[model samples]
Target: MADLWVGNVDDNTSDDEIREFLIKYGFPSFDEIERYSGTGTRPAVMLIFHDTTPDALRGLQSRIHNMFWKDRTIVVQVMPERDES
Candidate 1:
């Protein structure tokens, strides 16, 4: 499993748009896509996939990284797992 982080996404970009983008890039189905936004800041989206291989995660990351959307370059990266403290 992996959580792919895509930062600097335009606020106007919808989850459906992100889904379509993922589908266009060869992802069969995503577990979930969540958007985070703050006032006066660019929104970020996280694409989660379950039971995914590392190579597949890396491939998705590479494919989405530097991709342009709404005139902003997408910053894609593998999100580190949260530590249970």
Candidate 2:
């Protein structure tokens, strides 16, 4: 499974908005929305997933550019599978 990063999001951004983006970009998501903890009212958020294809991730990378947040862009990364020995 893979995951795509959608962070530095506005708290005002709804789940539907992200969902619409994902669907438009051919990334079907099946996880609930997430919210940031320490930032008070306005906070960054991440949309995790079980699998977001490489192609989709690439597309998202282009779209999410330097401003995951309109006010400021935050670092976004894809988490690789951890090898468990």
Candidate 3:
């Protein structure tokens, strides 16, 4: 599994919109998504890919990182693998 953190998203952007954006950039459909309204300043989302690898996500991360989307400059990062012991 892998987790991708997408920050600086527009508050009005819906989850489905984000999904479509990722798919348009060659990303596979994420398994799940979690939204965070951090300080109400920069909204973010954590997308979980159940069958994807961190390396794979990292490769795709740059496609959208620092890219302008929905009138916001987006930040994309592939989270480190968690130690699920």
Best by TM-score: 3
Lowest summed lDDT across 10 adjacent residues in model 2 is found at 75-84
Model 3 global lDDT (CA atoms, 0 to 1): 0.93
Local error of candidate 2 at 60, Å?
3.5
lDDT by residue (1-85, candidate 3, tens digit) is 9999999998788889999999999999999999999899899999999999999998999999999998889999999998889
Clashing pairs in 3: none
Most lDDT-accurate candidate: 3
Q: What is the lDDT of residue 13 in candidate 2?
A: 71
What is candidate 1's lDDT per residue for 27-85, written digit by digit as tens? 64678888888564767988888867546878767777898877998888888765538
Pairs in clash, predicted candidate 2: 2-51
Q: lDDT (CA) for every model shown?
A: 0.78, 0.59, 0.93
- What is the descending TM-score order? 3, 1, 2
**Candidate 1: residue 10 lDDT (0-100):** 90
Q: Which stretches of candidate 1 lie over 4 Å from their true place?
A: 82-85
Candidate 2 residue-wise lDDT, 12-83, digit = tens:
778887677557655666475567755554465566665655555665666555644446565555556445
lDDT of 3 at 19: 91
Each prediction's number of clashing residue pairs: 0, 1, 0
